[model samples]
Target: MSDLGNTFMRRFVQFINTADEKLGEELIAPNAEFYVPFQSEPLVGPRGWLKAVEVMRGGFPDVQWTLEELVVEGEKIAARYTMRGTHEGTFFGVPATGKKIAIQTMNFYAMANGKIVGERGQPDLLGLMQQIGAVPAPS
Candidate 1:
């Protein structure tokens, strides 16, 4: 992998763990597309991605992501990870419960010209909330 690719990967990881949205646009390409079926809203471009992330943080403060797997081939990277957080703040209408939560996620990113152009992720949002007692599981 090129140096730019490595840097991009590292920065992406940092952004995720820290929830530093300002660091996003610098690493993501303009017009980047983002998708996560479980997310209630659409996120497109760096700014939109940041906004969505903020919403998550607002709902689940202290959210953190750990990179368990990172594989890169050419211009594409796939990452499998888990997220940790505490529901100490209002999240999805749930009152601050100060409950800790963890969830698994898998994401793929396509790099173009050394910047992320596309990203798709599968996040177990509802399952996480249920695990943390923030929601009731279906029968």
Candidate 2:
């Protein structure tokens, strides 16, 4: 992968795991859009991206996002990652369970002008919920 791809990957993961809104503004395009599973509507621009991070941080204050693999194809980047944290606050109406959760996530980021223009993510929501006791484990 090119340096641009690797660099953006680090910055993007840092922005999400740390709730760095400032970094979001720098790395994401002004009109960028993100299709994320957790939200009903698509996230627009850096501010909208930050909002999603805020919601996540509110529930997992110490969340850590680690990139396990990355592949770059022209202006698109595909990444496989993992997030680990303890549920310490309410999340989408679910109360804290003080459970440690590890969820796998995959993402495809589209870049333009050295900024992220769009992103689509798929995360292991079922596993995450089960870890936090929101969803029951299989029998």
Candidate 3:
């Protein structure tokens, strides 16, 4: 992993945890594409990406993501992470339950000119729902 890639990864994690859309705007390219497994269409550009973050934060005001592992190679980075939050607002049609949830996630990113140009994330939605009592756990 090049130093630049490593630095980007670290900065990305910090920016996400901070929930600062302004700072996030600077880290992404104008035409960046962000993909989430459950979304029908990829989010376009920094504005679109920030909107998604805002929605997530609206539901989990104190949400935090912990980067467990990151590997970068030739401008492509892969990360494994866990997101923790308290269910304080509506999310995906599920109302607040005042429960704390932690879900695992994996993401891949493409970078160029020190900005993120592409991203794809797979998150544990079922696990998250179960933790928040939106879905029942198996007996």
Candidate 4:
């Protein structure tokens, strides 16, 4: 059942890194729901998913995604991934820091019909800001 979730993640990685919207279409359902903190809108389709990733990559041109752990059960999958990138373009009003940053992220994905049905994106925002020198570390 959830084996589809694992397959989806594999295809997602290739789609995101390559900016291949066509392949992305095959990885997400027509009405997939995506929840991300960075964006106010819940992405609704593959086109939206592709656009969102493009914006993220534009902000962090050297972004790299590293999957550290993965778990699957029935129709759900949980993945922990590390992201490393340089701030090369403006992001949500923050001027480019030109600093390399790493953020630890976890995602829960639900799959149906070999495509993602639901996606929840979570990341360590505080750690990322601190690593990028955007904020001071806790004393």
TM-score for each candidate, following the candidate numbering: 0.83, 0.93, 0.91, 0.89
**Stretches of candidate 3 exceeding 4 Å from the true structure:** none
CA lDDT, every model vs. true structure: 0.79, 0.88, 0.85, 0.80
| Cα lDDT of model 2 by residue, 58-104, tens digit | 89898888999999999989999998988999986789999998999
Give the C-alpha miss distance for residue 66 in model 4, angstroms. 1.4
Q: What is candidate 4's CA lDDT for residue 61? A: 82
* Pairs with backbone N, CA or C atoms under 3 Å apart (clashes), candidate 2: none
Instruction: Give the per-residue lDDT digits (tens) of candidate 1, residues 36-137.
Output: 674665577888677767877887768878777788899899888788888877777778887788888888989888788988888887887797676798
RMSD for each of the candidates: 2.6, 1.3, 1.5, 1.8
Q: Model 3, 21: alpha-carbon shift in Å?
A: 3.4
| Best TM-score among the predictions, by candidate number | 2
Clash counts per candidate, in order, are: 0, 0, 0, 1
lDDT of 4 by residue, 65-132 (tens): 87778898877889898988998887666678898988899989887877788889898877877766
- Candidate 1 vs candidate 4: the TM-score winner is 4
Error of 1 at 128 (Å): 0.9
Flag the better candidate by TM-score, 2 or 3.
Answer: 2
| Candidate 4 deviant stretches above 4 angstroms | 1-7
Candidate 3's residue-wise lDDT over 64-95, tens digit each? 88888888888899999999999999999989
